[model samples]
Target chain A: MTHLLEAKFKITYPEFSLDVDLNLPAKGVTVVFGPSGSGKSTLLRCLSGLERAPSGFLKLDDQVWQDEGIFIPIHQRKIGSVFQESRLFPHLNIQGNLLYGYQRTPLVERNLHLDEVVQVLGLGSLLKRYPEKLSGGERQRVAIGRALLTSPNLLLMDEPLASLDMQRKAEIIPFIKKIKDEFETPIIYVTHSMNEVLQLVETMVILNSGKVVNWGPVEEVFSDVQLRDAVGDGQLGAVLETTVSEHDDKFGLTRLDFMGQVLSVPKQNIPMGKKLRVHIHSKDVSLATAAPVGATSVLNILKAKVGKIGAIDPNGYSVDIELDAGRPILATITRKSLSNLNLQIGQPIFAHIKAIKMVHEMDT
Target chain B: MDIPSIDSGPIWLSLQLAGVTVGLLLVFATPVAWWLAHTRSRFRVVVEAVVALPLVLPPTVLGFYLLILLGPNGWVGGPVQALTGSVLSFSFTGLVFASMLYSLPFVVQPLHSAFESVGKIPMETAQSLGASRLDAFFTVISPLARRGYLTAIVLGFAHTLGEFGVVLMVGGNIPGKTKVISIEIYDRVEVMEYAQAHILSAGLLLFSFFVLVMVYTVNRRLPVQVT
Candidate 1:
């Protein structure tokens, strides 16, 4: 079932004001992608009814959380929020911490079993430990489990991975993905990291300075040059789901079937049938009018057709490419590259997607 | 130890004064400290300053003002007398009232800071988890702010136990009725009975010191740190 969460709210602070109207998809991971202080987290807070909007409306799964005179307190809203800082109660043991939210939901409203959450978060051994005894990653996992055990209608995550190391972040992505795909409840995931947005979500809401700059499907929004400007260098966009085919050792390459073509990347040891997450920052990419026969680069090039070119800023530009041999890749190049390649709208080109430059983060 | 007066036994009178003052201050100050720690009201600093006034004011100054208030023909004194058919001035009950005011901030400021340091996050998170405000206060804030309570109770008790000027002004050192330890020692000294004064003074010193040391040492063990 397609779900919808609509909100239009305004909050005023000492020197800043956040006024935004957001419409997020009901299922899968809908990412709120934006720059810092763009009211991304504030939007999440408004959705959960944590910060009441003086004059606004919010609806989640046909339930009105807040609209004019109608206001539902946070506990009554059934929206679970995971703050960036793991705000676990220090006095409670790990089991007590988890049960803190579990016991809150009415007996009639509880859905998932207690043992299942402990298993999912690998918390069976940590039940007796205090909050301070656990590491940062452990605390976050408990936080996730605590929210899940609450059986909320929706989960709101405000950059939960921002405080974690890369390895710990990778450890949690599969769990987040499982919640996104296996569960019916929709998730509003907020992040300033494009890699995170690309790795977990299918829908996107691009925000800038407390306003909705763009919102649409993940692929379409990432390709938008204006939105590309919203997400800066090295974090630019190209996302393709590729399945492992075989490792070509003679050429030191691993071949994958992506979209409609057989593409190759550096000798990745991923087993057969496993999928890989490919994120190519627009800046690290180069476009060519002809597929060069002899290139020193060993892997990760696709034959794509140029769709449209647009000016993202005064000095930079973005190009949309459809990789006929594989999945589509969105490449943002400079105005100079476009002119030098003599590329125009509707021109066919070879995208030199670099092997080492592309980022690969695994998910179950 | 045997002193005859219109009042009853010395030990009974001292107990009444200590009990009344400790109970009254603890009751009034808990809520006041909670509010001082929580409210973002613009007048909080002013209220803080006023609450702290008794701490620095000369004991006699505080006592003089309270004496006038509780004295017959004075505003509070007349109302209290008319309602209860008894005057508070120069009585054991009056000494407790005077001592409570003198020790108000000692019990309050530490508790307030303790509550403030406990923060709103844990309480708020607990409330969102469906714990009521009262439940959160007891289960979360109280456990985290345990040291504040220890500090407040000990300081309040010790401060009142050692009160001198205020007791002299309001309590009037009536033997067997209004003479708390500090005043007992003071009275002995005034009559040039140095040996008696030294004994009582040493006893008080040992008692308050032991109480404070035990409180602080035990409180140090439960220091709160969030993960």
Candidate 2:
């Protein structure tokens, strides 16, 4: 079955107008990524019915939420939105806040029990605490749980982790990943951080200047050189979907299998046989024309074919190389390295994997 | 000099008037205040100015208009009198009606500010959580605007308690019926009853100070405290 979440909106402000037409996957985490003032939040608001665009149409799966003359009110649309700020009800303790949505959702439509949501988000201990009393991470976890308890058909998170400190963000990312894995609901996550995009997105939409520059599976969209540059600021990177093949306890290393190649990294707590999405930044990778023998400091090495070569930096010192090593990965080498090696498309090469950082580990 | 015992009739009447007036203002002005706080409609300015008219218009001037409006042949009074066959002017209901207009802004402004401070963020969150606009207002907005309710209620009740010119113009100084505390004090002073007037005036002064002190203290204590 091909389930689709479709939306078309035309909203005109005094200074800016947002016009978007999208047919997004109805399941999995779809990311809307863009720079500031690109109308990412505005588009999310249009979907949520908070900002009504005069000309709009939205249909999720078999249901039509909005058409020419008919528009479903926000509450009737069965959507749960989490904003940058937790926006939790200050007066209500966590338990009360969580149940706020629970009580509103029709019993027939309610999918997850309150206890299940609490345990999933690890919010049991904080249930008696108020929003003001909880830490930023704790508040966001509760906010996510509160939204989940609503039994929404669609979940919209607009920079849910933006307000948190780095440590707090690390604390909440796994829970967000957990929701994607455990729940059947489709999630539309809006963010500007390339890290978050790589970590969470399955279907990625690149929004620029109120338009979608690209949209598709994260792997393909990110690997395409033209679309990768659309992310801006030269933060282009590649996302690889891999599985944990083994964890060497004694050696303190984890081995991940991607396509047919295995790469080893510092040991992760993730159990063996778990699937993961790892992002390798273009700048982080180094290449060699021929395979290097035995331990230099780099733990992993793989054979690759050069796909595309281009200068993606302002200073023109570094060149971005797209490689095919079972999966497309980006590597940025100095202009000097590119010239010295005489790199060209279709040329055979070796990607000296100096580092392999897990974007996020997911168990399947 | 020995102080004469104050008659409780006017004091009791004033308390009743203030209580009823505050109650009516909360029920009527709450929705109006919420609208004024959130609406982008062009009529918002005109509505706001009209609600605030009582604050700037002299009490006597407001009372004069109410007197005409609530009179048997006047706008409100005519319809109301025809329906119920009772004079709206010079009645307890008349005093309440007069006080409601006089203290309109006192209740509306505080609630307006409180609602504005709450902004649309929480309400939007609530709506997204499957709460209707009405449900969100009561569940999310009302709780957050508790401090506003306190300020509005205290100010409304207090303002009504000390009302004089409007009460006189509309209700007149009908002893034991429409004679509020302020009117009773005036009557005492007019009759050269200095000791009785002194007792009532001083009591009101102390009571008002206490009420204001309580309001300020509570306002300082709770960030969102409503009760």
Candidate 3:
């Protein structure tokens, strides 16, 4: 049987309010993406039972956590939550912190073992030290490990990397990915960083001004022109899931295959057949009416058909055009270029891809 | 100069009163301090001012009110007299009750600040990790606030040990019942026993200084020190 998570919440404060209704598959990582003050944290808190919405309904699979006149306390919700700060108990050593939740979870319900978690988070050496003794990255890893040890049915992370510097964030992303891959617990991660959304999100929920603007598969949502403001102008792009098909060691380039088309990027150390997420910014793509006959410096040129065209910027100068190569891709072009090329819906075209970034390497 | 022998009676009584007062105050003041630290109710400021009244009010003023309230025909004393067939005023129980009121702010304020410094995040994190509210308080908050507990215990004990005015008004200098060290010293001075008075006064001065030193030393250490 397929597992599903359903949630509906309406919470009001004096200045801000949060209203959302979401039914998402209880699998992988569902990222709640928004800018600051967009109620991302509030929504996560409601789901975790930390904040009680006066009117809300929530259920994970067959278990109902909250409904009309029925509210479960936070401790009874069986959720593991990690906040922006690594809220490790200062009094407890790393080993003790990790075991805190594990010990509280009933013996019959425990599934994730302490040793395996310690190994995955690379926490073996630091187990004897207290939270104050560890570096920021180490402390966050312990916090994540502490949450995971509870064997929760769902995990909620509210900007777990927000407090760390870029170097520390880079240090911890892999462990987060490992947890996503190894654990069966569905995760609801809240983040304001588009980079985090690209690197970790499988499903994306876009929150704007205390409301959910859009929610769907990450690739489709990223391609939506309506998300231009929420995701920032520079971040409007397409996410393509591709597999490593060939390695050209001589040219220091790697080839990825997606939908019978090949995209080459700077060489990656990942072995062949590994799946990767390639992020293509809309600004990097240019359109041509006919296939270029002569040699071009751009390595990737794919034949696609224009699917939709609409103005994304408020001034109507720049337009975001959706192109259907096999999977949908988005390109941002100026009005001068659109009229110069006379681009229209259903027009067959050639897309010149100037750059591509390999965002995440999926574990097969 | 020859050293005068100190009477052990008042010293033992003072120790016992301070011990019992500290013990009882810890239990009663903890919940009040926790509530003050975390509550958003408008009554918080009102309650805080009320708890702090003893700190600012004269001891005799508080004692006079306690004297009236705990006397034979007064509200508390009347109810107690009917139920237990004993008077509350001028008794050991009355002195203990007065000391608890007198030293309440010392115990509650340190604990309030400590609980405030510990903040809401750790408690929420603990609850999210499957610990109940009570369990989290014992496991996470208590350990984090140990310094505050230490300070509260020492201050409450020392403050109760030095009580004189409130005990005098309520307990009326009853020997072996409510005549604690401070009153004994006063009695010695009254009878021109300067040498004996000097001994008890000097002992109290040294003990208070030591307690203050311990509290300040702990507070000066790095807050996250292990244990």
Clashing pairs in 1: A3-A26, A261-A325
| Candidate 1 per-residue C-alpha lDDT over B11-118 given as tens digits, one digit per residue, 9 for 90 to 100 | 455556666777788779888998998898999999899999997899889989988988987787888899998899888777877888888999898889888887
lDDT by residue (A1-364, candidate 2, tens digit) is: 2358999999999888899999987677899988888899999999999888899999998899888997999988888899898888888889999999889999999998889998999988998877888888888898899999999889999999998888998888888888988888789999988778767777888888788888999888777565544676457777888888998989998888988888887788887788888877676788888877665777777789999876556777877788998778888788888889998788889887766655476445
Model 2 is docked with a DockQ of 0.51
lDDT of 1 by residue, A148-219 (tens): 778888888899999999998988887787776555667888998766876787788888877888887776
Model 2 alpha-carbon drift over 4 Å, by segment: A1-3, A243-264, A267-276, A285-302, A306-321, A333-354, A357-359, B1-6, B224-227
TM-score of chain A of each: 0.88, 0.86, 0.94
What lDDT score is found at residue A23 in candidate 2?
91
lDDT over C-alpha atoms for residue B142 of model 2? 88
Model 1 chain B worst lDDT run, 10 consecutive residues: B2-11
Candidate maximizing TM-score: 3
Best by DockQ: 3
Screening candidate 2 with a backbone cut-off below 3 angstroms (N, C-alpha, C), the clashing residue pairs are none
Provide chain B TM-scores across all predictions.
0.89, 0.95, 0.95
Q: Please write out the lDDT profile of model 3 over residues A112-157, one tens digit for every residue.
A: 9899999999999998988888898899999899999999999999
lDDT by residue (tens digit), candidate 3, B102-207? 9999999999998998888878888998999999999998888898899899999999998778999999987888788999999999999999999899999999
Docking quality (DockQ) for each candidate: 0.52, 0.51, 0.60
Docking class of 2: medium
Model 3 chain B scores worst on lDDT over the 10 consecutive residues at B218-227
